[model samples]
Target: MIETANYTAYFDKARLAGRKLNLAPAVINAILEDVALAAIANTDRILAENQKDLDRMNPSDPKYDRLKLTAERIQAIANDIMDVARLDSPLGKVLMEDTRPNGLNLKKVRVPLGVVGVIYEARPNVTFDVFALCFKTGNVAILKGGSDADYSNRAIISVIHEVLLKHNIDVNAATLLPAEREATEALLNAREYVDVLIPRGSQGLINFVRNNSKVPVIETGAGIVHIFFDEFADLDKGIGIIFNSKTRRVSVCNALDCLLIHKSRLGDLEKITSRLLDKDVELFVDEESFKVIENHYPVHLLHKAEPEHFGTEFLAMKMAIKTVTNLEEALDHIAQYSSKHSEAIISENANNIERFLNEVDAAAVYANASTAFTDGAQFGLGAEIGISTQKLHARGPMGLEELTSYKWIVNGNGQTRDH
Candidate 1:
């Protein structure tokens, strides 16, 4: 359980700050700009602290990649924050307005979600992203980062609180807890204070939050994303898409996990395998896909895919490959194994592209493109809190708008419920 002594005070202060922030989006923007500069000024300090965490883990661990924050990444983080500062306000905007039959003028207006609790594993960059996004949209954030990134998170959160204090904003607008399971559980169950909880990390973490949290949760990670190269796909173009999606940065949620190729394109599979080999990508190939390029590919990293491999999200330089006989088989395989984060199809045929786009159920479905574009920044939504896999109040790349809910506002002269 949380020690209300400190936790309650923080939430109360954050709630009040959230309400007050509704009238001060400009101040919020300035805070973001200042915070961005803070990161740049503290890059050496941030990376030094991050190195402490990294030294405790093996480079082979995927979490290591997620936890590492370098100078370039800090710069990128700062740039994205500035991008968020440039975005228009998301709160208090009228979604819709009209007059009802009883001559009552009604409108739906967006409102801040109050306090947002974010429980995430590794990735200290998320600390900056979540703060900038939540602050921009007027939602206070309580960040509980993973134990591995404890030092890194502390350094980052300290900077955030420092910036907030400088701007005379309540430090409670952003809070960081010691990374412990007990503390996470308390945060998960903080329904009385937190309006919403978002978990971004491994499947285990996401599942635990969903099963345990009394507060409403928005899931952000665990991507068993896939891409299909249909028979009609432009093979040269398809190869580039696959290479970029799978090899660009495998530690991300939007990175490709599986590759589905039409049986007719068996030769193209060899080319794709050979190209992946150059990037040192390990291939977990299905029986059919293995047979197609077993001896010809000449890559030691290649292995036959197991049942578990097909269902796995390889957040590394590893991926599963399946050869589908037809489009339906490819679609069925994706539907069966997808975490619904991002799925893509590379096809020149209009019908195949249209059907793939329409029939696939995912946060992002792409045509002749990589799944890498499934990001809040890439979608022109500034910095994203996370990509929601579940469909509820928010889905896909969660931007400032996702941190808001709407209420029905009624203008009535004389309204009666019984009327």
Candidate 2:
């Protein structure tokens, strides 16, 4: 319901605050500790606000789980904030140094990326994550959360602002823009103020941001994730891994969306997906997989696959199953349909695993494990802005180090270049 007439004011403030943020590591940690404590202390209030947002959405919607926050989820978010506070600050670390023959010393040191503007949907936890990760790196945060979670996002931002005000830090250092579409448009065009824009949401949202934004965009791509059940795959491992990958948290980006089984392993398909039955997972299966799973899986939840089913990121308890003749066919299928988010191969054969890991073009490649492990906290980076699928700046879970860029520092005493 809140709208800003001049969103540029927010961007300007963030840019200025970013340029001025040079606190000592201890100060930053102290502030972050206060924020974490504040979040936990305000648990009830955050929940109450979160409930308002949840009430507006259908519970059956895939984003409902992502939008709704509980006491335990809030506690986990606070823990991640503390984890970020405890990690070593990457700023000022000399990445490279050289002494030139011209009596000049040169060094490249890590620095913040300045103003990081994140446009995301539904997930209110991203507010805390963007703040924690950006603040840790001395980068300013300007978040534009979706309208669906506006109330929850606003509540979380207020807690952060309370802590910032207590520390006499500029509240604008972490700004949450209005949850209106206009705010998103303003943010997309603010290239002068925002160093980078990271979009975390559906493929449609990511694509929209990438195609339209004037600001340099870091694509946190949608996961049209897949896992291949190789002929040599251990059936025991394949069963458990696929189950967890699809059912552990279906709303997450890393949750499995497609399963590729070797033609020889088609017999084992029913057994592999046996656990998904418990979750009532809907399967869009190819002819081979459908024939194998026809009467095995719940008839109500099974359907023959269409061309559209192959590349879809079903952020629900729905998945697609394809039958590949060999490793090459599996690889080709994934290469065609994958969003390059996460890809996996379940196999005991060392050669097959190596080939899959090396040849699979994705942000993360797994061997005999669930793609669900593709996360920042699981990777030990505390929290992440998003999993970048692009090749330029960052790829995979963007952690503290990924939030930084290097600047060259040169020390010279009247040493000038002469031709």
Candidate 3:
């Protein structure tokens, strides 16, 4: 088992190398291209290892569903690496440059965040995404993935390590924690080793990391996304967005969990609800929505939405249904209930769309589009480490640029402060 101190020493060395190399965007892209090719070439080995992991996993285990990797999944991971290779390098670029009246020049330049600690769960694809993003941005990353996907994650990490070694780069730039739960706990408390901790998975996991981690934490919320269909919303567009948002890959964090409709639109709610029911979606409807749909369909009726329901991240075919009096009410409901992850307004009215986009306090806000578009690939970010709901460091889909921080560079001729 690798100790936390050993991991910290590796990262410290990587950071020193990063500061010295000052890698250009083109060079970074080339390295990424090599990594992508390595992954693709080793696809067969990767999939075989992943299948072995799946076979050993218990089917009844809650995480079993998230641990399986298919051919399409592997291809998607390879494609994501290629896409990341094409993105602009996030290091050494000048963000701002100016000269003071006294001829002292100042520049704000992009720099790596040094060493980042990523704790994630149950998706082998994340192994690739994290490696590419951190490597491209010149940050050393320590990945502590879930035990369920340990085999797959290790296989992918091995391929990446090979690529780094082939390029004469230190393999320690990306380190994987030993497959042990206690190691993760120890790593979380190692603030001296880790600069920041980014956890991606269940709300429980994020909460655990936040509470126990001594390192700076960037909280990524469990998404409780919402879709508000205003009175003036085009029925066709509304149905399309809602269906796509809820049904197109329901297992993701950005999937819609609640649907809010204007009360005036209740007359047409039956049609929408019918379509959703046909797709096997369970509706947890509010009192008013229940009355309109109860006569035609069976639903889980509740008099009032509990605070827990409002903040619940139902990452499945279940959704909470509510009817608002007006756009204002809908906005208020969203502000109060949303997880600040993603929100959408399906309406033809420009004023309403503008208001929703401007006022919604979320990582991604959409108008006349499905909340599902709040993804890294959809937003042209190549690959994302995770979707950040936190406001301080990074928000929205976290790409290469989000993985970096900025520093000020000054050029002056031997001048003393305040003579």
Candidate 4:
């Protein structure tokens, strides 16, 4: 764990190193391939490091699964990096060109956001994803992961640095800091070196960064996601999507947190929740939805929904259910509770679907689909740092292009403004 003073030195070195490299896609791709190979080849060692962190966590703890990096998850990271490698470079591209009447030629070209900083929770995959995306986009990365994944983050960063060393590239391009509040505080206000700060994890983490950081912040990944079961929904399709969204990977941010059902479509509630019930998903239902299935099995699993339950993001085998009178009510509920991350509506009615798509304020709005598709890889953007929830700079799954800023280059021969 490096202290703040040392981290500042590292950040300075990284910024200079990144500017010197002016990385091209070929070199970045080669480095990414080596990183992927190293991760796959050293799976045993990596898992061993991850185990040290996992052993300290309670099995019932929702974050326990998040902190544990298995073979499949590691492979997914490798595959994503490979995909990013194959994509075209995002930097130095000419976005727009303009010729002024006064003989000034102006062009807007994409450039790296310079040194990017990310402060995240126990998800170790972020270590590799951040490294890959930042390297590809030619932006240096400074990472500060949660203390729970200290061993895992260290191991991952070591592998990345090994790749850099092999390529004779500077390792500071992607450096990790100590998992402490001091480091975080230093990073938040390290506007001198860090070009931008992106916080990925719980709502609390995002809020903390937004309030404390002096550097520009990009808020991501606090999905109080919702799925609406409209009256026109195809029950078979709706059931599977809801079940998958809620149960596929409950520990992730994009997993469904709330379920809104139209009053007329309450007949098949049990059918949709059957899989969730099998997984022992607890249901906190509003008055209308509760009376419909109060007599069902697993009496302990059923509970009356409280005010807090509606707005909470349950990163576990739990969800809140509320009955809505119509599309307007459903839209209103989602507007009030959504973290502006991901929202979906299961309806075949064209008008209802269109309204939902056009009005929902989330970063992603899906019709007749699961909100789980709100991912960088899933959207064909390769590995994402996180789903940006804020409106400025970027929104939705942030990819290589989102990691860049544009600068206007003007060519003029003594052109002066006329008074």
Candidate 5:
């Protein structure tokens, strides 16, 4: 159980630690490398603790896959840490500079968003990702991981603290709060210490944080993602992209939830979705698609889609299909139901492709590709803290750069402001 009264002390320590995180770039990289090596060295221990969390969850639960960690996933997390170590730091760079007539030299420079607080669900990998990106960008991290992965998160944080202590760095640089409801409430109210709060989980969790947090929230919106199969879509390409997007990993936010099919392309729906049969993907079909695919798709997996199914994020082997008369209808449906995370169109027509890409208001819009690639590492940013669906501060996959904010630096020699 958490000593809820000590929440303020935790925030205070993290805030102070942020000041000391602006270390030299080389030193930061070295620390990250050590953490990566330590992760590999401690893989056995991490997996053991992760199993403790997994045992509590039923295998059928959507979060079960995310909560379980294996040696391969641990190695992948370690490799991503190494990738972060290799990348150039985004801190201290001059974004913009100007010289005024009054002899005032002004420059906008990149800096960290000090004391980034993340409230996340069962994905313990986020603990490492948030710490690596925040540390690389000279920011402190305060993690409020869900109780589902408490054991795993504690294990991961222990490894990080061991490395930080060895390097004489403050372990408070990456503080993991107690995994309890009281801790979450305290974090939501930590406006004085936490600069920004990021929530990564279901829509309910995101909404709770956004609605309740006194600290500014950067929402990692739940992915109610869609991929439109236009009239000009290539059968082969569409087949591959659609299959990979839905079945690659269903528990992820980027996994395809609703598939929009052009009425003209309804005939090709079976060919496009035939591969999903391998994974026993359950399809919730509309009136039109139901008629076309009812005989083709397995009876056990095929069901008539209700109104609620279109906007739902099915983090499982389930998917919904909607048939649209034209591109305009598809766009309208997406605008109505999309969470604006990742949207894609599989089409060969240049005009239709350009229109879809230009009009869709998603953080990551794709033409002739899978939505599954809506990830920071796939976009060549190593690991990501989360995918920001909001437009104000950051959008899409958040890397080291996204974790930073800019400040204006002004210099003048005896120049006084005249009002």
Candidate 6:
């Protein structure tokens, strides 16, 4: 049981230790390497434990399948850790150095955010990702993963703690909360202990964490991604991008949730819509789009999209479809409905592409590319803690640098401000 007093004491000690360690880049890199190797070594055990969890869970549960880890998934987690270690460390670097004419020397240096509380659901791989990113930035992390994958998460955390202990590092640096909802609630309210709270999962979970947590939060907006196919779009590329975005990996945060085709391209909508149907994607088409493809395909008529659908992050094989009059209309629709997570414009017109890229307020805006590329690994940041849709702190796939904050260090020769 994590007593409130115990948590407070642990946090104070952690902060003190963090100050003392002043972890250098080389030390951070070495620790990451060790953890990666440990993760690789324990892949078999992680998979077995995950399978056990899956067997006990109801197959109908949405998270049951997502929580299950295979050998390949375990290997992928190890790879992500190694990738994070290869990236540049974001600690102790001098961001700026300057001296005033009054002989005051000021230096801004990058520093860790002390302690990060990561609350996530389903995916057990997040355990490794959060540890790698946080430890690399010299921040201690307290993970509170969903209960569905409790056993698997426990196994992975045990290996990480063992690795930390082997290197004489504090094992509490990578702590896991008790597998209980009440424990999570307690942690959320423990604002004095946790420095920042990052919730990664469904919209509901993120909302709950944001609303309930007393600690500062970096909202990783749930993805309700969209793809707009302009009249000038290359049919081949647009169709391919849309299909891949919707079907490549439907069970991710960045999968395409909606597809918008220009009304001028209504003739081609049937062909593209047919292909999506082949992949079992449920289409919710607007009046114009329905009129164009209704004869050829069976689709659910969407008279009006609910406000919820506009911001909904459906991590499944479902998508909404609409037809716009012009590029302006499309852009307006996107601005109104988008989650500001990821939006794509498939147009061969350079002006349209440039406009979309510049005007869209999102973490990632794509031109001719699929919305699926809005990933940390794909963005070449190694691994991500989470994708921040908010403008403050971190705005996209948060890697090592986003895990840190800045502090100004002053060197003075008995300089005092005269009131």
lDDT of 6 by residue, 33-109 (tens): 88888878888888788887888888756576578787777777778888888888767789999999778899999
Q: Model 6, stretches more than 4 Å misplaced?
A: 1-3, 6-21, 58-60, 298-310
lDDT of 5 by residue, 43-126 (tens): 999999998999899999999988889899989999999999999888888999999999999999999999999999999999
C-alpha-based local distance difference test score of model 1: 0.88
For each of the candidates, give the backbone clash count: 0, 0, 0, 0, 0, 0
TM-score of each prediction:
0.96, 0.98, 0.92, 0.97, 0.98, 0.93
Scored by lDDT, model 2 comes in at 0.93
Which regions of candidate 4 fall more than 4 Å away from where they truly are? 1-6, 414-419
Candidate 4 collision pairs:
none
What's the true lDDT of residue 370 in model 1?
A: 87
TM-score of 2: 0.98
lDDT of 1 by residue, 1-419 (tens): 55544466656676777766764777878889999999999999999999999999999998888898989999999999999999998788999999999989999999888899999988899999999998887888898998999999999999998998897887878888768776787787677889999999999989999998899888885889899989998988988999999988889999988999999988788888787887888888988888878887656787988889987988999989998999999999998999989999999999999999999999999999989999999999987899999988788999989999989999999878885
User: Please, what are the lDDT tens digits per residue for candidate 2 over residues 209-325?
Assistant: 999898999999999999999999999999999999999999999999999999998888878778889898999999988988898887889999999999998999999999998
Q: Model 6, poorest ten-residue lDDT window?
A: 299-308
- TM-score (C-alpha) between model 4 and the true structure: 0.97
lDDT of 3 by residue, 202-267 (tens): 989999998988889988788899999998999998888899999887778888998999999999
* Candidate 5, lDDT over the whole model: 0.93
Residue pair clashes in candidate 6? none
Task: Give the C-alpha miss distance for residue 41 in model 5, angstroms.
Answer: 0.8
Better of 4 and 5 by lDDT: 5
- Please give the distance, in angstroms, between residue 34's alpha carbon in candidate 5 and its true position after superposition: 0.7
